[model samples]
Target chain A: MNIILVGLNHKTAPVEIREKFSFPEASIGTFLTQLVTSPLISEGLILSTCNRVEIYAITENAPECFDYLSRFIYENQKYHDNISFDQLTRHLYFYSSTDAVSHIFRVSSSLDSMVVGETQISGQIKEAFDYAMINKATGVILNKLFKKAISVAKRIRSQTKISENSVSVSYAAVGLAKKIFGDLTGKTVLLVGAGEMAELAARNLVNNGVKNVLVTNRNYQRAVELAREFNGISVKFDEIGVELAEADIVICSTGAPYYVINSDMVENAVGRRKNRPIFLVDISVPRNIDPKINTLGNVFLYDIDDLQAVVEANLKERQKEAEKAELIIAEEVETMDRWLKSLNVVPTIIAIREKVEAIRKSEVDKTISKWQRELSEEEVGAIENLSQNIINKILHFPLSALKAEAHLSGGSEVIETTRKLFDLAEEKQPSQDPEAPPAGTAESPEEPISRSRDSRENQ
Target chain B: MEILLYKLPLLFYFAGTVVYLLFFSIKKDSLSNIALGVTGIGFLFHTFILILRTVESGHLPLSNLSGALSFFSWGMILTYLVLEYWYRIHILGSFILPLAFLSLLSAAAFPNEIRSLQPDLNSSWFGIHTTLTVLGAVAFTIAFVAGMMYLIQEKLLKSKRFNRLYYKLPSLDLLDHLNQWSISVGFPLLTLGILAGALWAGDVWGAYWVWDPQRIFTSVTWLFYLGMIHGRLTVGWRGRKAAYLAIIGFMGVVFTFFIVNLLVEGPHRFI
Candidate 1:
């Protein structure tokens, strides 16, 4: 069975939808059992960290299994039946077959995680996979995929400084603010929409020693919930302008159709706030705050795109590690491919034996008729023995070639072509379709996964 | 046994310094460990050499120009190891290693007199006086190195040069703490050392105080460090200004050790 991972992540799913679909720590075992029990699924593992929920399955139809997982998680599944493809499809990413394998390698390696080059997610992915293994829910395919991902993660860590710095947008916004104000202890934070992205920004601001956080949301209860968690006060949604006036840092992540913080409201806030330099971050999709807010004096407004430059520089630093990580992945994949290809041994030996026996029988019959009148019975017996020796000698070269090819993978081009020319193609006697379950992961050849586990576990 | 106890250390010192200098040019942090290791091995040999010399001479290795100077230099090298181990201040090594080499060179230049204790030096206070002053001088040299690094670091920080020194020097706050911390300890120890010297003078020379050039210069170094320490804590002096003052204080101590001993014709004369 081939390894496959298919699902949406922070990059593919909207904040609201992703939040609704996220799995808690308590439900992983049940989810794993459900995923593995599917008709097409051979073995499966689920990696459901905050940023992603990827279902890695060894299966014939990954799309069906992946879709089933999504449907199970999406609480309001009925609404999706009427929704346009663009509405749902834009936010759902899919990778098929080997591409699915590569994507999972990248994800479990944290190369695709929202915070590029983060090391935390790899360990968490391994923990998820190991838990599945202990339950016997994960078999060979998942074992290789998960273990390969861990090796890639390690190669990246040793080779690069990807995790050396905080290059996330939330952090960049705070860093830019620090450069502007030189200090953030007395700053005011005004958050829009109690969205998860908004909460992360709030937490970053609070970490920089923010004194007060003024929160607003269309849902007052959500605002109250966010404010209580962050030790802040909730204001009426209509009072955003007045609240904006009192704040030094404003982050608008409502993902509203129209601008929530309009130019006029910002202009008034600028005047009311007395021209103090304010930092605003718009993390909303579809653009919550107007782009024109950046034109205001003493106001530094950054959209999500603005954060890409910071992440780009950090990505360069992490690229060094990514190369090493990818090399490790390519090596592991080739080894696994070799094992999968080697399972053709049974068919190869059967075909070789049948061809040699037919050649011996034909030569024996032809010689027996010619010598019937002139030779003694003992002479005919000697001819039969000589014919058997010739056949036995002929089979040696092909049998050795087949044996060598079986230990490795696909037969030699010269040997296989010769076998076919000599009428030796019917292998394994066509016995019941030679149905072999996908090649099993007999403990990884070079031992990267076991090495890492031993290092951590023994310690 | 004699080679291990004596000449081998001098060879290790020369070899260790070369390795560190090469590492400084090549920008290798690992080589810093090699330098430290080689020098650490030299330090072990030097300790045995000093003890053997002291035992053979029936002295504490504090007598004569060569022995006193060698002991003082060894003290500098020992301080370097402590700082490197405790603070992991790799930047300090570039400055510290040279001072040690220079002190050892000066010690080599001096004649080893092996003079038996005279009545003036035989008093109960002589060992206390010389030991305390040498201890104070060691602290002074360490402070001076920190101050010098601080000056270079301040320029780099101000110019926004994020080089090796910028990254490796302890934080500005930490450097400031160390410079003042060394001075705070050094000045009072120097003061006590000088006070004991004067007390010994009263017992042997019939005066508790004298205006001898060596004594005056040594006392002057103590006061300079004292002033710097006081200025830093109370007046909030820092960065380059504090660094320069530390440099000045160390110059006085070095002057007392080298110039005053060579040129002056008082009780603390080298020639």
Candidate 2:
């Protein structure tokens, strides 16, 4: 069996095309059920997010699987009239076998994300896998592939510093506030304007557990609307000084050509604050708060450029850490590849062991029956145990050599040679009984080996 | 055996200092915990030595340079551990543990032979004065470390170039707060120590005020910290200015504690 992935990410396709292929969460179950109906696809999953749409599958025929999936996506979106098959194929990128496994690993690890080290893509992939599992659209191969991918992503997150620091402007603003106040639990935030940037900063702060939000804008109705969204209070823009005194943090983002908050106003507010520190975030283009306010006691004012500088610094740090994360992913991919190859030799090893055991059992029975003197059951048992130990010791070296060679490149050649030398294939068919275990029984040593081989031949 | 016990603290502290410096260079946070554990063990051994010395001499062992340095190093480690527990600033150990180690190593350079307590140093006031003064010096040492951190962080912020070291260092606000706290706590203890010394002087030397260089310089150091505290409270002096004052005040502490004892001959020269 082979692993295959066909999808278009932010790098390959524009948002317009990506959106056309996205599967809504409510419809993903039905979509996955429809996808695995083809005989080529044994298991499947679909990851749909704003930045990318991916389909991961375990299949017998990788080329046919790729064609069917791309056609499926094109038709499911009802785009036959708007786009041609060749155009849709141009937008989709396909990977087969180990490359497909590596692609999913990088995607779940966020190394393939548009943001490089984003955390949201891992969760989205997990949700997609869980949905596939619930709909019975996934089986053994896809299950192991996703589990390994998730663990690789987890290792990358913990062992590297890629996701430790904030890399966004709004997050940096919140980080500065945390450094100043230590804890923002009961602090009040006063929003000076209703701009998008100011709302984003307020939202970040609120998420950090700042419960009291005071909104003040030139437009009173907009202020009330913004305040109502956060379940906060609305104040007048004219009363900025009063609110500034009451707030531990003030977010200023207005379109005023001049400074909305000057040094003198901050000086007075600082006096009233009784030495408590205040954080001021000025996210305006023309600069709403005076830069001189930073020099005042008990007041920390950061302008847009300063916030951007912090974000840039953090991004550089993450980039340095990404190099290390890549090394870790490379090692994990090698390990997973070795494990997948090692699965191929299990049936041969078990077949050889069973063949040797059968020969030893028949020879021991003939020796016991042909003995001249009538021997006791204990003497026969000792002879049988002695013969079994010799057979095991004789088979140990070749068995270990075969298992070791299975992990190297061109390992299937060794397995084929061993099967032919032992004539194990002819022996395997005649020994099969109606009462024997199923093909992929968990208790049997040859289950996954035979199952995987059957799927490969079925292609 | 006693000499070996005295030297063991120096060895442990040196090891801790090496580990801490390695941590600083490598940016590995786990090394900091190992450094803290090593330093804590060194501190326990130093405490054991002090207790042994005090039991052997029938007095607090603050009468010689070796005793004073050991006690001073112990006080600094105690203060550092407390601050580390409260602030959770692991990187501070990288800067402070070497000072602690060097102090103990210097103490080892002096003879470990216990001398008889001098007559003038036998008073209860002598013990109180020396112990309190050493604690005050430890606080100033902490302030010095925090001040150094503040300056580095300030430089990074001003230049807008943040390296790995910049992230490892504590924030400016936290460093400044530590500086202020150390000064606020150190100043009062130092003032009381000086008052106790004056009373002890009057009893031993038949003079409440003396023109001895040690006496004069201790008073100078006391007055400087007093001015710092007054400025901080009244004029809202903080951040860069406060950091500078804390650093300068530690210099005063070192001068009064070490230089005066060695160079200046006065009634307080029992060591």
| Lowest summed lDDT window (length 10), candidate 1 chain A | A447-456
Categorize the docking of model 1.
incorrect
User: TM-score for model 1?
Assistant: 0.56
Give lDDT: candidate 2, residue A219: 93
Off by over 4 Å in 1: A1-31, A38-42, A48-120, A123-136, A139-165, A168-459, B1-7, B14-28, B112-120
Q: lDDT tens digits, residues A8-93, model 2?
A: 77777777777777888889899999998977778999888888777888764555567788888787664546777666667777
lDDT of 2 by residue, B196-249 (tens): 888887778777788988888888988998898888788666777788888898
Q: DockQ values for all predictions?
A: 0.03, 0.30
Best TM-score goes to which candidate? Answer: 2
Model 1 lDDT per residue over A253-274, tens place: 8858999888898888876655
* Colliding pairs, model 2: none
Candidate 2 CAPRI category: acceptable
Give the per-prediction TM-score of chain B: 0.93, 0.96
For every model shown, the clashing-pair count is 1, 0
